[model samples]
Target: MFESLGAFVDHLRAQGKLVDIDEELSPDYEVAAAVRLIDQRLGKAVLCRKVRGCGMPVVANILARRDLLRLAFASPNDPTEEYLRRIGGSLPPEVVRAAPVHEVVHDGDFDVAKLLPLLLHHEKDAARYISSGVTVSRDPQTGLRGMGIYRIQVCGPRELTISIGSPPVSDFLAKANATGKPLPVAIAIGLEPLSYFASVVPVAAGVDKFDAAGTLRGAPVPLVAARTQPVEVYAEAEIVLEGEMLPNTQREDGPVGESTGYYHAGRSWAARLTAVTHRAHPFYYALVPFAAENTLLMGVTREADLLAALRRKFPSVRRVSLTQGSVAMLAIIQAAPASKEEATAMVRAALEGSMQVKTAILVDADVDPHDLNDVQWALSTRFQADRDLLVLRDLPGSPIDPTATNRRTAKLGLDATRPADQAEAFMRIALDPAARRRVEEILARLT
Candidate 1:
């Protein structure tokens, strides 16, 4: 696996998976527009060498596609499975005296707005956001470190409003607020792809997110003490913004376009930036919300978690996919069940496995869960509304879902497996082995 963002970018360039944009682009909307267009076309990540006013370059769409993820994980097979295997255990981080991120330090008075190329992702966004920075904090009570990607609005040169929506960051913030102390935080931007992916993995309480990154790296992740904050950041991170989340300080920080493809307005906790440190010549990373990268980064780990959970309950569960078009609100499970009851049970297990999943579909083992066509076919031919459709009401759901009512939403499960007794009657036709091979060989030569 690549060790640093620079190394990964270099490797991607070598593999023709990265594009260089020499034209000066504005961070207001042009950069985000280019990232969106590239993602929509399944194109390479862009390296914008010139921003209108910023000194550093901007990079976006770093890992928007499955092929890019495959490169980062160095997996010959499924990257999600590889991630699952790596996360089974963790390697502790190795602290060092100094690192490249501290090559340039600005602790006193600095203007973040004029320094970094923060992107304005959507037209309706309240302000330019540091959308890709991984917020690293330590639990005040347990002393365990945690990392999470959060929406950080640029309030001023040295001020930010962060939405502490989930745990263990929220849990840490509560403990700090209980004692009336500010929670020390270090926002690391432009980290290795694996470290960013590891941050979003739903590890259990008391588990250090840094250790998860180490596991994904297959070696200890190097760490360095922050210049101003009482926290450690990945030594190779391109930039680190050291700060503290003030206790009992609230700020109105909303109307930002979220991954759900809607504007979400809410209150947020205020943070005072103490310092900003980075490499002398750094690259600012930007992530466009509601884009492919946002969905893939959040979906893959959830799919792995759901697959593991379902398999533990039902050994017949073969594959699971968090459909991207649904923004991971829908799950498709491929499994072999002995009866209709077993299929329905598997679907329920999937929905319960992750709060993000609002709809689940269980298809026969022959169906490919990742393929929408295959899943739709199974739903059309094998499912009956009265017998196979299950609706669950008033269940807990992710608040980001705009369709949800007061954080409560209804869920659905569709069993698309063929009737067990009539399985023989529902057998699918297949091409003859010799004929198929001959046709494939001819097609290959023509291509």
Candidate 2:
């Protein structure tokens, strides 16, 4: 695994998975447009060497492919399961004195907008947003550290609006606000793959995310205390912003595009920036909302977490996959069901395991959960509306879901596993081995 973002970039470049753009691009829309194009065509990470205003280079689409994540986990066979097992074990972070992020510190009288190459990804986006910053905060009650990826919109010279919709940051902020005290926070930007993966994991309350990150990397993550706040940040992070979320402060946040491919209109609490620290030269990471990188990073790890949870409940669950295009709203479970009841139970277990999954489908071990076509075929052939479909209404749902009414939506579960009695009827037609070999030989010769 790479120790830093720069190292990861170098790895990608060597593998021909990264593209370097020398032309100057505006952070307004040009950079985002290029990133989307790259993702659509080549699926490679882009390094914009020159931004119109900012000095640092901008990096996008780092986590655009699931294979990249597989490489990061260092597991070729079962990356998701490996990631789950790794994160399940905790390794406390090592607090160090000297760190790379402290090489250049800008305390007081610095504008965040002028410092970072924040990108305006969508047309209706209110301002340039820091879409990839991992916001770190500690619970005031238990002193448990929490980390989450939140949208930080540059609202003013030294002020930013941060969306705290996810846990346990949201819960931490609420507790701090209840005490009428500003919540101390440190935002670490441009982190390595393991730290980034751990930041997004929905760990239970009181679990330290830094430990989870370290465990994922098979080592302890080095940390350094923030210069301005009483918080710890990744020692090798490219940039660190120390600040506090002001109590009882709210601002108009988004009309910006979210992972759900819809503009989420809402207000966010403000974080007053106290200091900005970074390496002498750093790469500004840009995660475009609703894009492949953003969706993959958010969805892939979540699927792993769900899989881990489901496997504990139902050992028959062979594999689990969340559809990437759906932002993890749809979950497919490949399970070896003893009976129809077990299949239905697996579907329910999947839904309970991951709240973001609005639709859960269970198929036999023969079906590939990752293949949308395979899952759809099973749904079309084996699923019965009356007997197989289970709909749960008025369930808690994602705020970004456009179809949800009042942050609540209906969840659907389909047991698509073929019945035991009708196994032969559902068997797929296959070509004879000798006939297939003859066609392959001819195709190979033609190629």
Candidate 3:
């Protein structure tokens, strides 16, 4: 596996999965537009070497493709199962005395907006955001280190606001708030791919995230102490922002676009930057909200957990896939149900299983859950809306979802599996094995 972002970028370039633009692009919108277009059309990561004002280059859409993720796992089996297997063998992080991020330190007055090329991804965004920073902080209660990706809105030269939605950090904030003290935080930006992926894992409370990252990478992650904060950051990280989340400070955080393809504006916690550390020439990592990379990173662990839960409850569940275009709001499950009642139960379990899953489609084992076309065909032929569609009233839901009312959402499940009574009638048309093989050989030779 690649050890650092630079090494991974080099690998992407060698594999023709990355494109570099020498043209000067504005961080306001131009860089985001180009990144979205390229990712949608060719599914390539973008590296803008010349920003209009900032000196560091910007890279986005690197985690958009599953093949790239496969390279990280280096496994033939499912990534979710692989992650589950590797996570059980946790490896502790190794502390280091020196790191490249400490080579250049800004301990005094400095403007964050002037230092990094923070991108304004959406038109209605309240301010520029650092979307890809993996924030590392310790739980005040347990003293265990935790990491998560948070949107850091740059408010001023040294002030900022962070969205503390997930736990360990939120828990840390609560404990600090109770004591009228600030929680120290270190935001590490642009590390290796596995570091970011592991940070987002829904690890149990009190579990150290750096160890989870090290487990995924099959090696101990080298960590260096933050200069200004009491936290530790990945040693090979390109940049580290040392700060403290204020005890009682509140700020209007967004109108910024989120992973749900909608603008989310809310009052969030504020923080003050104490120091900024980085290498001589660091790459600024940018993530476009509502894009494949954002959704994929957010959904990877969710899908894995959902699949594991569904399987434990219903042994018939074969596969689970969170549709990428839905922003992790939709899940397609492939299963072989023993009866229509069992199928409906599985569908209901799926919808209620994950918070992000607002729509669940249950397809038969014959259909490929990952392929939308195959799932659609199954839905068209095997489903009867009146009989198979199950809708539930308002329930707890993801806050990022635009359609939710008061953070409550109505969810639905569609059982697209062929009814056992009509199995013969709904039998698929197919060619014989020998004949299909002969045709495939001829087509292969012709190609």
Candidate 4:
């Protein structure tokens, strides 16, 4: 909702989820550091109305918490299940002619320094980065489109070194490279918060990302063809940049701090830019790349992948949770596994589907898989470390993983499910629905 982002911000302020800063905020590590701190201490979105150099106001941490996420994915229910069910639904993106993002254009004098509040995050980061750009690209061969939130470094007013690896988009970019063609891509920044979450879904190649965005919103996302390129982009997008990744173009991308609260270097892939453009008074959107949004976006992809893997072997798999604290590396599955081997197989399938996954636990159906304490408790009571814990080594984890020691890392699977022969014995809580409903009704009335 290009037109409605202002309304959403107003709503956030009314609901106490948005923080307004009218004081001087610098584009350097100052703004970035503050956003990082906001994410860590009191998770909330921030809108900086004043920055030291820029004429336009800058809004950072727009998707800082579940409150903002709920706003993005709002429906009769909540954002998580409501948005996810859409992903599994048939709603396709409906393209429109044009919108507000194209109201003004400035191409030849592409100076991000003059416009956006490009931030230098860590003390050691090489230069200021356009860290939260939603890069959109199309397969040169099949013409299929993909998009993801990728980091871009502000090398010059005319250039942004985009990271083109790490998933569905990268895989397609690789295919475009092998065929000796330039990857036609566009970066769309600053749209409705729900649109940002929709970009991060790691669906396989050939699947349209915009359609997925539409499905998640329970409607079609409107798109406009970029003024400079063939790529159709978010017409309501505040900033859109068209570019090309020439075959074999590469660079030394990062040593920046990542999601694990540590540093990673040389894992960076590279690309070249062709054009940079935005709205006349574009409010640049950036996230503290390693903060809450990063954790949530990545975890959502992991959860999707994990669910797919589990359902393949264990048809009884009821739920799969990618925990908030342990990151995507840890997964817990709720299942009615018929055998010990079947429980173990569920874990194996999870690890195989997710390249970065480090641990998987199979638990009895009675326990809520979403709770880490419940999973941990299951591990403590039902699992024998020597017998039920299976450790795997030298697996390929997420290259972005700071915790994984290269190919030397190990993944452990815990078979926390009750023994197949005694399934009924460990079926812990035995509450009748009528009794539970009566207690709920009494609590509701008293409150």
The weakest ten consecutive residues by lDDT in model 3 span: 66-75
Give candidate 4's TM-score: 0.83
Q: For candidate 3, what's the RMSD?
A: 2.1
Q: Model 4: which residue pairs collide? A: none
Q: Against the true structure, candidate 4 has what lDDT?
A: 0.73
lDDT of 4 by residue, 263-321 (tens): 55653445545555666677877777677777887676567666766676678987777
Model 4 has a clash total of: 0
Query: Total clashing residue pairs per candidate?
Result: 0, 0, 0, 0
- On a 0 to 100 scale, what is the lDDT of residue 387 in model 3? 95
Q: Model 2 scores what on Cα lDDT?
A: 0.86
lDDT of 3 at 152: 87
Supply the TM-score for candidate 2.
0.91
Q: Which residue ranges in model 1 land beyond 4 Å of their true spot?
A: 431-447
TM-scores, all models, native as reference: 0.94, 0.91, 0.94, 0.83
* Residue 251 displacement (Å), model 3: 1.5
Candidate 2, clashing residue pairs? Answer: none
